[model samples]
Target: MNLKAWQSLVFQENQQLNCMIEDILINSSNMFIGDQPLRARKIYHDKQCEIGEARLMEDYFVDNSTYDDAIYRRRYQMRRSLFRCIVDVVIANNDYFQQRPDAIGSQSLSPLQKCTGVMRVLAYGTSIDAIDEYLRMSGYTTRDALMNLVDGVILCFGQAPQVSYIVNGRENNRAYYLTYYIYPSWTTFFKLITFPTKKIYKLFAQCQESCRKDVERAFGVLQDRFAFIRHPCPVWDKDNIGRIMIACIILHNMIVKNELDAYLHYYNPTEFLNNMPTNRQPESYTEDDGQPSTFSTEFELEI
Candidate 1:
């Protein structure tokens, strides 16, 4: 072949090489254009959540378990039956508490384990990492469990005790049974005379002061029952702290209701007075409609 023919063949081969390179680049671009971005694979830690569940059951839940009833009550700050009822309510309210398998088909933590973890945190006010060895849950998992438990408790039991008592003295039926003195002078709030010049005013003040002590003592009982409230909360979030408090109060009410019979049977005046609501003084009157009127007493005094 002539030199021109040889050069032409080399030029054709160069064109073929350029086309191949372009095709390779185009294919690479197409592969990544619409694809999901690469993410680091999650490291799976064998936390053995099942073992945690079994250990919890054997420790307190089983019929012939490790701890006795008194020990269970002291540790959990409530009875076993009440605890189980709360667990059922939580599981029913939120699916997160329901035990389910993870992506790897291994069963995640059980409902009992999640609630037990939460109760441990609330009952003792312990750190999240403190439960790691026995629960086999990471800090993240335990925190998640706490949030879920708060939500569940609030959802299930938050509103039940609110309207439990209906104050019978009001015609409108909207008056609050027990209103704090700090609240505004709405008819709902029972007001006291700042300076009691009259006998009736002095009597009202006495009754109000007595009732206020009952309220304070009720609060004291709550603090005594749950150590969580007695200590400074470790949670950084203000909202979570409030939620945990509300949950603790609801649990307290449930315990009181469940153990009312037993408490009455073993009545101690100090304990009973601390736990129960204040009895209204015999100062209340009745309206023409026959429903009791305002809480102040009828005075027959000659001035």
Candidate 2:
């Protein structure tokens, strides 16, 4: 070949070799590092959340509704009145639960729908998507509602305080009843005797054992009422899980207070009622330091 042609041919061969080397490096890097897997595009479902709110109202909330009080209580895990009260309180405290308009001026889920969605998740321990059919809500929206509802409850009802009790009346020797049974030596704890001598001691042991069962029974009822308490929490964040538990406990206490009359103990309720000091003033509660009431991330990203 001519000198000029030979020079061009060598340059072209070198360029081809460099391109092949570059292609090999890319292939090796891809084999080891790999390209990012494709993420599914979000599918927007036209969940008719307004219709869900109306249906929920018709089924449980309205006067002379489709379902009776018993059915409402069974489904909602609280009386209609109490549910409404909670809805009102949460809506006032957390704007996320309140009904708002979208970019197109379409109304989003109402407070009732959001609260009901969270309630159903807690009460039934069902998957987040399970209520999509009835509530006409997307799973992401329901999960967001759950987080917001719990945050609102913790902010509104959470309290930590220090107090000393004073016994005033002569009834029952003016002894203060111990309500917490965590410590074995505490009055509320039923410690078993190592050895029993007298018949009364044996009887006392039996009575103590029986009373202890009541405590177990109380725990069982709590778990039964809120099935999610017993199940493994799907939330990846530890803080979110703790918030959920605290919120459930607060709700349980509210239910107990609302339905106190339903339980009839043989102990003289009237005597205990009278023993409560009527003139005692209430102390201002010192709020404990906690995480910020609102999450750092937006509601849409909570799930």
Output the number of the lDDT-best candidate: 1
Which residue segments of model 2 deviate by more than 4 Å?
Answer: 1-40, 165-215, 264-303
Question: For candidate 1, what is the TM-score?
Answer: 0.67
Q: Clashing residue pairs, candidate 1? A: none
lDDT of 2 at 259: 88
lDDT tens digits by residue: candidate 1, 53-96: 88988998888999988998998888988889888988887988
User: What TM-score against the true fold does each predicted structure earn?
Assistant: 0.67, 0.62
Model 2: per-residue Cα lDDT over 224-271, one tens digit each: 888887788778899998899889889888999998877855345564
Clashes of each: 0, 0
How far residue 215's Cα lies from its native spot in candidate 1, in Å, is 1.4
| Candidate that would win on TM-score | 1
Error of 2 at 101 (Å): 1.2
